[model samples]
Target: MSDNLQNDNVVIESPEPVDTTLPMVIYALYLASIVTGGLTALVGVVIAYVYRGKGPEWLDQHYRYQVRTFWIGLLYFCLSGVLMFVLIGFVLWLVAVVWLVIRCVKGFKGLQEKRSPENVDTWLV
Candidate 1:
């Protein structure tokens, strides 16, 4: 009975662990950028760049997606800034915010599932 109890208490671990810490952190930073005025996103992008290609291939997809998100977002913001003179920049800015949020959320979901993003190369979520 004691041996049975001991066996029941034994914990079995996976042969290979999946590490999603950095990806989660990057996703959080991206979401926080909405309130932080893009500073956290800058940090997140830098981390993504530094860590890209250093992990599992599935994880590399996320890093690529994150890096693209930062650059594409910057482009959108710049275009919006230029369009402000015509009064359309405000709307573009709103769209950019929504796009960023969607991308971050999608990335978070993929990370949770331990899978690569489906559309890593797309500009839209």
Candidate 2:
């Protein structure tokens, strides 16, 4: 009698949890880039491009943000290298490091809040 009563009218409806692996890996790569001369950042860009549109809505921003980070950092570093003759490269190196650090920190914080970045395509944070 108790079993029938419990099963007759009860219902459970819970939404599936969000997957966080990709975001976590991207964030780690951003950090590791600072330490590993950006080899991990290159890997992060590949992951971002491959999985860009394959995740939840909120996740798209992360992929875009990460990809932007990689390409823009690459552009800055390359420009810096090319302009090394006049000592501008050192200044660019400083700017690129600060830019990357800020963007990564902001992205990680946004991920923790389960929110998308406002300006994923911006060159600077």
Candidate 3:
């Protein structure tokens, strides 16, 4: 009876796998950011900050990567807008578009594979 009681009291605890929704939302936000010309990324940024600490190790990388992408992309766009006066904004804008596409594609692909980006901490892709 004592052995039975001991066995009953023993608990096996295991951590749950990271939720998939965060990465999907991040990916969607990237798409929306591209479509809206960096407008909706602000909302994405907010989500990133709000849930930054709630995720586990792997998911935290996505959050950081997303936050960096939004801010850097926004800064690039703003600079490009001002450079429009010098006939250079067009080129910068094109670069921003390409950068955004690459980031989103890479992020989505990573999530699809159930892996974090190779270097989520870097500004470059």
Candidate 4:
């Protein structure tokens, strides 16, 4: 009886694995930013910092894509302002589309049992 009680009382504490929240949130906000432009991008930036480094491939891909998207959008806007040509805009659009497809493929690969960094912890939650 005493052994049983002692066994029950023994606390089995295990440390939690490093969180992958940063990557996840960054990717999420990246998408939001793409959809809504700068405002969403701003939010995404904050989230990315907060999340920092999480072990989620989607998050990484999203962050990368979002950054690319943001820059491309800015370039497009600037080029449009300067040249005002529909053809230029179309070319920029094509670039963005290709990047999105590549990012999506990379993200899918990450999801398919790709080992991610273990010590990535951007946010507590």
lDDT of all predictions = 0.92, 0.84, 0.81, 0.50
* Cα lDDT of model 1 by residue, 1-125, tens digit: 99999999999886587789998999899889889988999999999999999888989999999999999998998898899999999999899999998998899999999999888988888
lDDT of 3 by residue, 17-46 (tens): 667786678768877877786667887888
Tens digit of lDDT per residue, candidate 2, span 3-40?
Answer: 99999979887867878678778878977887898899
Per-residue lDDT value at 59 in model 3 = 75
Residue pairs clashing in model 1 are: none
TM-scores of the candidates in the order shown:
0.85, 0.83, 0.83, 0.47
Model 2 misplaced regions, further than 4 Å? 1-12
Identify the runs in model 4 with alpha carbons over 4 angstroms from their true place: 1-15, 53-86, 104-125
Instruction: State model 2's lDDT.
Output: 0.84
Best by lDDT: 1
How much lDDT does candidate 3 score?
0.81
Residue 119 accuracy (lDDT) in model 4? 25
lDDT of 4 by residue, 7-42 (tens): 989998885554544544555554554466447657
Where is model 1 poorest over a 10-residue stretch in terms of lDDT? Answer: 11-20
- In terms of TM-score, the best-performing candidate is 1
RMSD of 2: 3.9
Model 2 poorest ten-residue lDDT run? 15-24
